[model samples]
Target: MRLRVFEAYRAAYDKSPYAVAFATCFVKGGASDTLAQFKIERAESWDVLRTVKFASFSGLQTGCIQHFFYNVVFTRAFGPQRTMLVAVRKTLAECLGYIPFVYMPNYFMLKSVFNGGSSLSEGLGDYVAEISGIMPNRSFASRVWLLCRSAGPLC
Candidate 1:
């Protein structure tokens, strides 16, 4: 359940350029430490068992690697000869990283949410409302709105 929500949040952000910025922030601000702290705090607050699940970490790293490979390698390797296969592979790889928890469960949940006629924008709005309760700042709302707008009408 928690993983599904996190994946939804990740997918919402992944469609926007903010993914790059978020990745940069992760790298520049100390990825391991920040992620560890986040896991620790989140686990404590949410009472999540197995807070440092190996599969979850693998999924997160896979997503990071996919983004890096796509932006750095795929763009250069394929150049103007992009194909549907390449795009699908990239998208799948990102999904793997974005939704690490309950692999099949998360995938199906997202598929149902997205394919059931709800717009990505609606999902993002819900995400923003949830996050606002935790962060409670103007900038967070501004960032969410900016990212949603950048993600287009569906997002």
Candidate 2:
């Protein structure tokens, strides 16, 4: 298994980042779902459909969307030659802009999936309830967000 992983890693370097990101992120997404299902949750049977859905969404978001985001932010928005301040500024902007638009929706969707609610309305209600329940911990989350935002790894 280690040998195979090593060979895959070595092989990836020859390909474009987009291709590598899509493949690896897809694998990682599926692997994560498998771990959650079989290991963490200790489920009796495989949930193949959920695993595939998670992987597809993960690949689409982490692989494809991220590529476009970086291209636009770095190349088109900020230009190629970036100063530290400029990069920091852009990163902060992205962090602020990302929460409601990207992070919240992704979080809600994934939570809805894992929650196993039968209907969209039920899942959405649960999501809203849980989010509101977490309001007390908002300070802690804010601090973590600030730290992460400063570190500049938004996606």
Candidate 3:
């Protein structure tokens, strides 16, 4: 069953990167959010709306853009050569360029746009603090990325 499922996913990914990426990202986002709610909020039941909001943001925006990033930007810029320069540049560019400029802002926007809350204004500081909580791991993760040399930041 597991092998069959893996084969099916591999076929889907080979057939349509966009759809596979979107679906995976959608599920990932929802699952991560669910885990967060369970761990942090101590929720007894699932929050379907929050999960949907996360899915929409992750699938429609992040997944699509990330496909371009992995297929075009990272592959073109970094390539498979795996030089120190490539690793350094890719890490810096992804960490500096994408996380702040592209990723987080879009996340906030999507959260605000979908949920219609004060995340932009009043809750901004809270979000920043939240982001700061996971701040240090990025360097290590990027370094691991250098070793793995996977598809993209997400992949």
Top model number, TM-score: 3
Clashes of 1: 0
Stronger candidate by TM-score (1 vs 3): 3
Q: Rate the local accuracy (lDDT) of all candidates.
A: 0.47, 0.70, 0.74
Instruction: Compute the lDDT for candidate 2.
Output: 0.70
Order of models, best TM-score first: 3, 2, 1
- Clashes in model 1: which pairs? none
TM-scores of all predicted structures: 0.24, 0.62, 0.67
Per-residue lDDT of candidate 1, residues 1-155 (tens digit): 99998797677766764454445444543545445657755433432222233323333443454455556654565443345555544444434433332343333434335445376455455555555575555577766654444332122
List residue ranges in candidate 2 displaced over 4 A.
Answer: 1-19, 80-83, 106-144, 153-155
Give the residue spans of candidate 1 off by over 4 A: 1-51, 84-155
Error of 1 at 120 (Å): 39
lDDT of 3 by residue, 4-120 (tens): 999999999889988988998998889899998899899999999988988878887668787877577887877856567666667677766876667776776666667777556
lDDT of 1 at 21: 45
| Model 2 per-residue lDDT tens digits across residues 24-140 | 788899999999999999999999988987887777778766766766654576665556665666676566665545656666766576567565556566667776787566687
